[model samples]
Target: MARVTVEDCLEHVENRFELVMLSTKRARQLATGGKEPLVQWENDKPTVVALREIAEGLMSYEFIAEQEIVQDEPLFAAFEDESNEAV
Candidate 1:
């Protein structure tokens, strides 16, 4: 298997925020004990599973920036509430 770099994982994480958050939560769970690695593919490419796996562990709260939802106050409040509920 090829070596997985941190940068590679981070790029994916930035682009796929929701998946990264889910994977990060899973990665933390999997990291507790000695466990085997899981396989994950990137756009049909056989990426280094380890990098994507580690990226999941390193997920942070990400804000999506788009035209319709970038500066909406109500959306921000709702999102904040949702985040609080998640915690």
Candidate 2:
């Protein structure tokens, strides 16, 4: 149970430029001591709403991994396989 600080959230938002404006506004509010959910538009759609969920430490790899649809197992395995190709 780790804590996802405001800084961590900002970093994600910065990397995810698709929601730049939304993340910026949320980040600014956080800097000013606000702790509400951060909503943002990604590609002109309401997709990256997990900004706050990630900030609250609720967006764990385990949680997401479960929800992910493994449609391309071979493709994923090829990328995940660590052998001579990695070296």
Candidate 3:
């Protein structure tokens, strides 16, 4: 019923882009039913619930950012190996 605005979440998440990424990732997790919902029923969409979670400081942004960085490392390494082979 309540609106979740970017400004409401900005204090918790310094970067707007990072906020968007983290929220979307959380939304995907919710969509896949991988994680339990932190908030009660509001008849909201997954993305809305995710944004609310972030705005309310229910999720850890640092943890999500670190996970994303770690997940990308292997892909980058594989790409580097392929480039080396081409060269």
Candidate 4:
């Protein structure tokens, strides 16, 4: 089996941390059977499939960032509320 290196995926992502986060989120989605992978094989795990997708530019960083922003809105709102209460 071929290993997917971070270097192979760097062109698709801005940095290693973002790559890791995106790949891991995709892997979780695959693990939960959320969607069919862009690339498919019998033996590869979800994490491997995610890395392959990243390396192949099948996933967009904008999509990931948007998802993160949507997910974080509640936390940000709560922080704002707390600050307002303190003021």
Candidate 5:
């Protein structure tokens, strides 16, 4: 199939914001080598692979929520550290 577009993914995820969040999170995981691509890679970038996975019904918000997504330190924590250094 041709490169998966946002329109294709929208069919699976009703909300654009939610679709962006899911695709972003999935891309990050793939970039870090923390998770395997649900769809064939085909030399596509991580984000593209992620979008394709979602477009093809291979990944979904509920499914991702069920998996343990590795989260980075919260944004507030980083700001706090910077503030302490400046104080």
Candidate 6:
């Protein structure tokens, strides 16, 4: 599709909220260079490519749900050095 609309992606995902979350997650993955786009490269940004992937049935709720959400900065980072020392 020329433009990747939410309606197009809705077929794969049930609700608009989940669709947004899934697309956002996919976009993050793309931005981080963690995964390659399942669709062709049209020089589009990460967000656009993510939406296109969803519209083309390459991305789905299951795919997003299975991925482990890793935090960039750990919540308890301050204790890391102490925890690593011999005890």
Report lDDT per candidate. 0.48, 0.47, 0.79, 0.81, 0.85, 0.84
Model 5 residue 78 CA deviation (Å) reads 19
Better of 1 and 3 by lDDT: 3
* Stretches of model 6 off by over 4 angstroms after superposition: 65-87
**What local lDDT does model 1 show for residue 72?**
41
Give all TM-scores, in the order shown. Answer: 0.28, 0.32, 0.67, 0.67, 0.72, 0.70
Q: Which stretches of candidate 1 lie over 4 Å from their true place?
A: 15-24, 33-37, 40-50, 54-87
Give Cα distance to truth, residue 33, candidate 5, Å.
4.3
Misplaced by over 4 Å in model 2 are 1-48, 71-87
lDDT of 1: 0.48
Candidate 4, residue 28: the lDDT equals 82
Top model by TM-score, which number?
5
Which rank order by lDDT, best down to worst?
5, 6, 4, 3, 1, 2
- For model 6, state the Cα shift of residue 68 in Å: 4.5
Candidate 5 positional error at 53, Å: 0.3
Query: lDDT at 44 for candidate 4?
Result: 89
Task: Judging by lDDT, tell me the better candidate of 5 and 6.
Answer: 5
Candidate 1 residue lDDT tens string, 1-61: 4556656566655555655554554444345533345554544222234345555554333
What is the Cα-based lDDT of residue 76 in candidate 1? 75
Which candidate tops lDDT?
5
The total of clashing pairs for model 3 equals 0
- lDDT for model 5, please: 0.85
What does candidate 4's lDDT look like per residue over 28-50, in tens digits? 87788466788865698899999
Query: Pairs clashing in candidate 3?
Result: none
lDDT of 2 by residue, 7-26 (tens): 76665444445345554444
Candidate 3 global lDDT? 0.79
